[model samples]
Every structure is written in C-alpha cells, then in structure tokens.
Target: MSVEKPEGPGVIAEKLGAWIADVHASALPDRTVEIARLLLLDVTGLCIAGRGESYVRATLQATDPGGACTALGHAGSFSAFDAALINGTAAHGEDYDDTFEGGPVHSGAVVVPAVLAACEREGLGGEALLRGIAVGAELMCRLSLVAPRAIHSAGFHPTAVIGALAAAGGVAAALRLEARQTTSALGIAGSMAAGIIEYLAEGTSTKRMHAGWAAQSGIRAALMARGGFDGPRTVLEGKHGFFKAFAPSRAPDFSPVLETLGESWIMETIAFKPYACGTMTQPYIDCAIALAERGVQAEQIRDIVCEVGEGTVHRLWEELAVKHRPPTAYAAKFSTPFCMAVGFFDRKAGFGQFTEARIHDPAVLALAGKIRYVIDPDNEYPDNFTGHLRATLNDGTVQEVRQPHMRGGAREPLTGAELAQKFVDNAQHGGWNAALADEARGWCETVFGEPALGTIARFRQ
Candidate 1:
C-alpha cells in the first residue's frame, strides 16, 4: 500500500531540503543562471562600496582577522564564518544590495556571503556556487511570503529573520549536503534567526550587522548539521516555529512556501535598486526629480504632500520634524522627506546625496521641513510599492505625479546595460581605480568559467 507523505512543521523544511539537495546547475534555466550571476555581481560591487563605511571597519576590528577565505574589498583573510559575516555586512552596510520585492528582504547580502565563504572553504566549483545562490535567494523570498508583512508588523527585520534560513539553505547547497542534513541545518538556523526593528528608532548601525550575523549563524548551523547534529524536522511550521514565534498575530500559510517548489523560481522577481535608499521611497524620489525637471524649483514650492502607503509611513514618513532633519547620514537615507528634498534640490539621490554635509545642507533641510504625507488606504504595499506626489507652489500652482510601480521590480526591471553601468559606478565610488574596476567587471563576466573562490579572491586586493 502507498503511504501518505509525512506531515508536520518539518514538512516544508524536509521538502525544501530535498529539492535543494537534488537540484543541479543543469536543472536551472538559463535566465535563472543569468539573473543569479547579475545578483552576485551587484552584491559584490555593493560589498566593495561598503568596505570603507564606519560600521564595516568596526566589524573588522571586532572579528579575528586571519584565515583562508577572502574578505571582499579588504586585504585580510579570515575564517569562513568570519568572512561571511564581514562580507555580508559590507554588502548591506549602505543598504545598496539587491532586494526581493515581495519580502523586501536583501537576500543577496545574506546568501551571497554565506555561499561564497562556504565554497571557498570547501573548494567548490563556480557552477555549484551559482546554484547555491539561486536556491538561497529563492528560499529567502519564499519564506518572506509565508507571513507576508507580518514580520515587519511584529517589529522584526525580515532580512535578518529570514536570512538565517536562507544562508543555511545556500551554504547547505554549496556543501552538497544530503536532504536530512540540510533539513537539520534549516532547523538549527531557525533558532539562530533574530533581528529587531528597533534600529529604526535610533537610525543606528545595528541594522547593518543583522545580515552579517545571520550569514555567520547560518554557517555555524550548516557545519553543526554536517557534524551529524540532529534538530527538529518541523522547524518552519511547528509550534513556536519561525512565523508563529516572530509574528504571533498573523496566521501564516505554507502554500507559498511549498507550492511549485522546483518549477517556480522566485529569485527572478528580485528588484535591483536604481536609488540607494529605502525601496519604497524610490518612486517618490522619481516624482520629486520629475517636478524639479519641470522647473518647479525648491523656492517655488509652498508645501510638499505625499500620498503614501500606511506601511511606509511608519518607517519612513513619521515624526515629520525629525525626518526632515535626520540625526545621521544613514538615517537620512531612510527618511522619505529627506530623500524627497534631496531629489528636488539636487535632481538626484545616490550614495553622494547621503553624505553628512548633504544631510545638513540648509536648502535641503528647509525643503524637507515642508514635506508631509497622508495615508492612502488603497495602496498596494507589501506587494506593489507605488508612490504619489503633489507639490503646491507659492504661485498657487499645483503639480502632481503618481508612480504606478517600483521601477526595478519584475514589472520594470533594469536593462543589462544599466546593471553593468551600476557595477562600474559603485566600484568607482568605492575607490577602485579604473583598471581594478574593469578587472572586477571582467571577473563577473566570466565567473561561470573560473573557479568560484579564485574569482572572488581577485576582490581581496
């Protein structure tokens, strides 16, 4: 007689583990492989750009600094775990990494580092590394959908909360673990998953470290599982499992997590940022730039009103006065009013727009002070990040613009040429000489052909 498949919290994890363990590079579509390479290139560029940030420097100081794996943008070598941690932090330090549009999680920041470090330490090949990244990113996006926006509503950073599992999944795939070991790794990682949304309160650096910590923790979990350590099979859907523990109020559906496991690839839906700020704020900045381009000078504006999603208002539009004059450069990046002001005043918002001097610019601050938002109940958030802007000029004229969708998402994905240019620009901003940046670009182009660890090692210098 045929037996029913085992059911429990572990059901999701078990199936996911089996799929991950069995998936080969040959099974992935060409588009998926191409997207994975693009993501790797984008994240590597972001890590290089973040190496000079104060938080990354601080992380370097705190960790033991000698081992075999290369730390991107730094000259030092470190243990696999430490390398993953540092590289993950550097990738996310500026909030510039690729984001999964649905979870709004920076999966690349967590998964890329963990998989890369594991491959380096294990002497794995390039194809395996790419496959691992694809699996990890897909899991991260899927897990985020399990609870929808519940993770954010419950005051948890989705990237950190879901990243641990994603990292573990990626590392397990890279290490070529069996289904049981991979499931165990996912279970162990669930306990390690953590990240509070409290960082939003102070505009602190704690948020940047979440990705790194998750990456390191995943490495630990996978290694422990490989060592024959056992863990709950029903970690994901069990009592006090990830969603229930983190988002107690929201009833999570496992359908999204388990449905179309190998047939559907969620990584393709990931969005690349054209602006280096909060993902939701990107469209608003576009609106502001449009107004500026139409000759609506800052001096001509009386009040700037934004119709925003209630979800965005809490993290980005609240405390109008404080947001108008953010306490720190990093804080300014998350402040919708500040970003709007920068766009109008400078006609652009990028890494250069978030410097201390720019954050404190008198003209920008004055314009930001007049910015305010009203909640739009009909907004498509935690799904579509649409933005609407209305500027009332002193001359009694009004100019309004509404963004139908986020620009870099699946709906309006960036072109290959655009992505290539972004890589070059980010590398230059990170202080790489032209020759070095070009060399890095070449490495990304031929990554599939070279040894994974050796290709990554070129970034060490």
Candidate 2:
C-alpha cells in the first residue's frame, strides 16, 4: 500500500510547491481532465445529497451566514471559508464521497469544496477551478501513498490531516501562487492539520466535520502565505514534519507523492463508492449481496465468518457487539457486520439504506449478529480492497464467497452514465425537483467547458 522505506532523500515540500506553481490547465491530459470533471460532479452531487442531514444542518447552523460564495442547497451566499466548510462537510456527511484505495483517502470531499469556494469568491473561470481541483484531489491520493495505513495505525484520519495540505495545494494552484508562496502555504497547512479516529468509538459526527475543517484550513493557509506569511518550507521532511507527527510508525516514502509530479496522474484511479458506507466495508457488502443472490437465504445461515485484513479489524470489526448493533446510522456505515448484513437483505447500501429506520430493522440486526470477522494475514487493504465470506448453514453446508476487489475502483470503475444517475439521485435526495436535478446534471456536463464558472443557484432551495 505504501513505499515501505524512504526513497533517497529529496526536498518534498519545495518540489511539490514548484509543481503546484507550474501545473497548467491546458497541459493536462484529456483523460485526466475528464476524471477531474467527474470528480467535480460527484463532489457537488454529494454536497447536495448530504444537505438536511443532521450533521450538515449542524454545520450550517454553527457557521455564520453572509459572504460571496454559494452553497448548493442553501439559498443565500456565505463567506468563502464558511462556504468551503459547509460544502466539504456536506459532501462527506453521508460518507458518499470518492475514495482511492492505494492508501484510502477521500479526495473530492476535501479539494472540491475549497477550490470551488475560492473560485466563486474570486470570479475565477472553469479552467482555474479544474486545475485547483486536480492539484488538491491528486495530492490527497498521492499523499495517502506516502505512508499508507501508518496514519490510521497512529490513530489519525488520513483524509482529515493530509487533506489540509491537498486543499492548500489546490487553492494555491487555482490562485496562481508563486513557488515560494505555495511552499509556505503547504508549510502553514502542516501545523493546521488535525483529525483523530476517536469518532469511531461512538457514532458521532466529528469525522464529517474533518473534511470541511481541513478544506477551510487549507484556504486560510494559502491566503496567509499569499499575503507574505512565512512558514517552514521544510514542513514535510523536517524532524518534526507532518509525517513524523501523524504517521509516526513508518518512514515515509516520497516516491508515490513526488516521482511523477505532473507526469502520471494517480487521481485518475479514484474510486466512486457504490455503497454509502466506509471504503473498506464496500467489498464486504458486495460479498454479502452476492451470497444473497446465490439463493442463500438469511434464515438458512447459522453463522458467517468473514476473512478480513488485519488493518481493518480495529475500525470495522472490533467491538464485535457494537458492530452487530451499531449505535446510529452513522456508526452502521463503518461497521462491517452491520453493513454486510444490511447489504445482504437490501441488496444495496445507499442513502435509503442508511436511514434511522433501516438501521434499526430487526432482520438486519439479527443478520449482523450472525456475522463475525477473522483476521486474514494475506488479505490486502489500503493497497487493494477484497472481501471473503464463509457461511456455515444450519444444515452443515458451508458456502464460501469472495470478491476480488472493490467495484467502482480503478480495476472496475463506474461508468459515466452510472455516475450521472448517481448524481441525479443524490440531488433528488437533497430535496431538488427532477427538473432541478436535470439542470444540475447538465451543469456537470458542461460547467468545465464554460469560459466562466456559474452559480448552482438553480439547485438551491
């Protein structure tokens, strides 16, 4: 999943700052641009989809109103930072944002909000927005590859901490910051980064806020640097650098993050989640759904043991009783036992499946109670997500099912048509009418082609 040891020493922050300063919209490959557009669409849709969610409402309520930027579902404009905060939180509120498996981080959730908010505030065009999104989202993916699971291993959330750096890079790129300025922005971002996995213990909403906080933090850092605020240019590789503080267990390998720079795109492989739950839990949900498809009724199964990667146990499998009976819908999204059980019964784990009513369903809890996990030494996670289920039937018949990898991932990505449908569905769920949803879809198709980016006012309530 990660480059095990450090590559022969290199100045990371300075090199990355140079690349961010030089990357251009016109120089980007066609396929890469297409990926960026899809990501833009996906993140916008997720933001709209997550509106009205309790966590989103809390964010909106806590944030002061009145600024120059637009939030998808809200009627009025907001400050650029507040808009970024709300949009980013809403995008990830339902855990429906895009993910990359190479190291497992959500790119769109963090980057799109910060860059788009800045563009709206500055009246920047689609090209600038696109470039910013590319820099930010791609950085999130590449950064994940630096130390991989080490971040999670150290009890920190990768998306939350690394996302600040990615957001800073994206905002700096969008604003055309100089190399030194960009380096200082990244340096400032390193200290601003903060997120812990303590939210996992309960079904709390703190994790949802991580993306937004990071996004805004990035913007603040970038703007501060642009204003001549100096910070450590060696923030990334110094003794007290970001990696040492967050992913303390491993020596970071800079290859995945620095080797290609703008040459090859790691963000192209970004995975859209088919399910609305956790990234690692997606494959297992597939396995359970497949088991149901094979005519193995829930009643016929006595107990099922899932073979899972050692890395996943703490987050998804541990607290066995809690996994079986997740405290809230939010908690269920991370509980493999509950997710698989729900997926098996419902055949899907989308927005509809994550409701308070559905999460408390008697059948789902019963099936979840029957499911358990056994750590498989050979199982791959963070690198490649796979699933395996061995069910022991009441009649002594054992049925085994395995999912080779996560669907909607680089190995088997979701089609544009599917993503479009998902976008429309998410818009509808967020309270937009069909016509409004269709308008949003049309916007996604052509927004990047526009000479100037426009507001999503049509999608606003």
How far out, in Å, is residue 187 in model 1?
0.3
- Taking all chains together, the TM-score of candidate 2 against the true structure is 0.97
lDDT of 2 by residue, 157-230 (tens): 99999999999999999999999899899999999999999998998999999999999999999999999997
lDDT of 1 by residue, 1-461 (tens): 95544565557889989999998887898878887898888988888788788898899988897877978889978999889989899888887788876678988889989988888888887877888889999899989888877888889999998999999999998898999999999999999999997877779988899999999988889999999996677787877788888878789888888889899897888998888888889889889888888877888899988988887777898777789899999999889999999988777777899999998899999999989999989888878888788899998989998888888888899898889888888888889888988888877767766655566777887
Name the 10 consecutive residues with the lowest summed lDDT in model 1. Answer: 2-11
TM-score of each prediction: 0.96, 0.97
For candidate 1, report its TM-score.
0.96
Q: Candidate 2: lDDT over CA atoms?
A: 0.89
Candidate 1 pairs with clashing backbones = 9-234, 10-233, 10-234
Q: Deviation in angstroms for 248 in model 2?
A: 0.7
